[model samples]
Target: MSQDSTVVCVVCGGPAGEPVYASDRECSITSLCEVVPSPTVVRFCQACGHVQTTEMPGIEAYYDTQYKILIESEEEDQLYAMSNGQKVYRLDHQARTLLRKLTPSAAARILDYGSAKGGTLKRLLAERGDLRVHLFDVSAMYLPFWKAFLDEGRWATYRPPAAWRGTFDIITSFFSLEHVARPREMMAEIASLLKPGGTFYGIVPNTFTNIADFVVIDHVNHFSAASLAFLLRASGFGNIDIDEHAHTSAFVVTATAAVQQGTVAGIPRSEIARLGSEVERIAAYWRNFSSCVREFEDGRTGRPAAIYGSGFYGTFIASCLSRPLDIRCFVDQNPFRQGRRLLDRPIIAPEALPEEIGTVYVGLNPVLARAEIAKVACWSGRRLDHFLP
Candidate 1:
């Protein structure tokens, strides 16, 4: 392209510097990345807050290959194991919560932009009998999950045929925003896909993720809330909002993007103490498990007393434990996960519990912890004392 037809920021049309690898883009019409080195590009719209991206040549083919290679039906086991692993579960919770916030009644028509296997859409539409959903994704495999939903009359799926730009009540993309080259244009596409004054829902990680996670893991850009909102406005979307877990806020967002100002924002902290306090609130609400964890010296053995429950709580607590109170083993119900090593310690199933471990810390959820303790004590035939009381 000539200098007269030169690229600008998609959102605000600012003079884009020629950064080596730019994520922001200028034009929504063209594919977003280009290889640049010397000037260092920063294409952003001043008025609309839109971001422009620089694309690498052949990026399109790469993304296509990634989608097919990843979501292929043949790799079901690998996908299932990784996709449903511990980390994804927590992230999924945020996605579900966002869907709920965006469309409360379930009576509206909804579309999940990158509907992988349609699991999230499936979960969102499960309760509301009035919901009608459509699935859109690059991979053809996602068709069946939505097909099942359609066949069950749970949702009606539609593939945007050539030149088919229909309006909808709501549109959503969970963890899929960073993958697009022209985020501004993609935002425009989303708006065009929605009816006038329609709602848009999205969830993106904070701009803290590494770029390698981008190149190798299907992400092209990492966006901050301010940048994202600016991009949306440039796309002709009037109301734009974005948020995420801040401070100790682990992984995931509690709500989706609502109409512009109505969207959630992460709790902001003005100072160090305030930030610490906010994180403490997050820990109390989401991360913390033990109300009070206390350890005592085992006078005779001197071999530090141990606790039970090998989940996140136990893992964290054990790591924080001091010299004399070092943990020896962990107990859990899931046989596959049990007998595993956590923090270099054995996570044994309760059946392996032995006598003389005497006092045990029940770090699991209270109700479930009690039941597990009962099973462990009964099955092991060991008179294990619990710390709950």
Candidate 2:
């Protein structure tokens, strides 16, 4: 991004719209990995209603080293893992949903791009035994799982551009495109990877649907429904359909590669402005959130406190707390993280929390924060304003 030239939208080659938020790069919530400190800049494009960061560093390194830590730990990272068995349920349900919409062929080639741990592909394989499934991901640490999950010679790491041109009937990416800085090029690559008239199904966070997604630093692309439609259409895709009901923060999309060039739908100015306003509103909410955290810590420095939800938000709260020793532990429901420690504090189950614990800051996503706190039987009817607000 040169000062002389305007930044272009990642989805559409439109003028970089408006700056919505600026701050230091936050810690990775998905992988719980440390990131190099840099100024974070989030902008929204008025032409396409796509929100993106202007500063995107080497993402490959982020995934290979920092992101791979979660894989090596055998916990699969919070990014891939879901709460309350929802990971399996979500994957199986999405696979079944997609299979229901498509006319399955006797021998269909399906590629799960960014197939972390090959879990999604595994479910798809079990459900559609006749399909030829393949996996692709940035982190090759999951390579070992492929042999057991898929047939031999079905997994791949980084490949040259268009290496498998026109080879698959379906190419799917779940929560992958938003991490890429060059989304337009990614769309083009997706188009090239699929056979003519092949379906490209993807799921990405809808920032408006879940405001917490708007704050995640790693998600460079904050796509609205309109922008996603534009991206697919601009990438020579047709018949784009979005299912917003699949996940709270996700948009499940199905599109087909066009045989020839086609026109794309442009977002209305009013809609783009509305999306930009949403960016502003989320930024304000976070500002108030940070302030509330600071106010709580100002005089209650010696209280025994813990953070609920050991994912990104919890990690972020821990980073903000001045008296780290006051933070006794982290409360998480993930069985894999129960006995583990994060940021030098033990991650305990809700039942394991000490009765003397003064405050338990809810670090879960905003959408689930209230409900998660309500589940703690020990804290029932307790004054939890300091913990949740």
Clashing pairs in 2: 29-312
TM-score of 2: 0.89
275 Cα displacement, candidate 2 (Å): 1.1
Q: Report the lDDT tens digits of candidate 1 across residue range 1-389.
A: 22322565444455543322322222111111212222212233332322234554455664444344224341121111122223234334644576545555547777777666666666666656577777776555455556766654333333354333555677777667766776766776777777667777776644232111212223345454555655665466654445554211212322222245433232233332342343234324322222244333223244334567655445434533445245677776555456567656677766676554765767554434566566543455555556541
* Per-residue alpha-carbon lDDT of candidate 2 for residues 273-371, written as tens digits (9 for 90 to 100): 787777788877765766677778885636588899777678877766667678889988777678988888899987788877877788876776787
Each candidate structure's TM-score, on Cα atoms with residue i matched to residue i, is: 0.49, 0.89
Worst 10 residues of 1 by lDDT: 26-35
lDDT on C-alpha atoms for all candidate structures: 0.48, 0.74
Runs with alpha carbons beyond 4 Å of true place in candidate 1: 1-10, 20-56, 68-92, 152-159, 162-166, 209-218, 246-389
Q: Could you give me the TM-score of model 1 versus the true structure?
A: 0.49
- Which candidate has the highest lDDT of all? 2
Count of residue pairs whose backbone atoms collide, per candidate: 24, 1
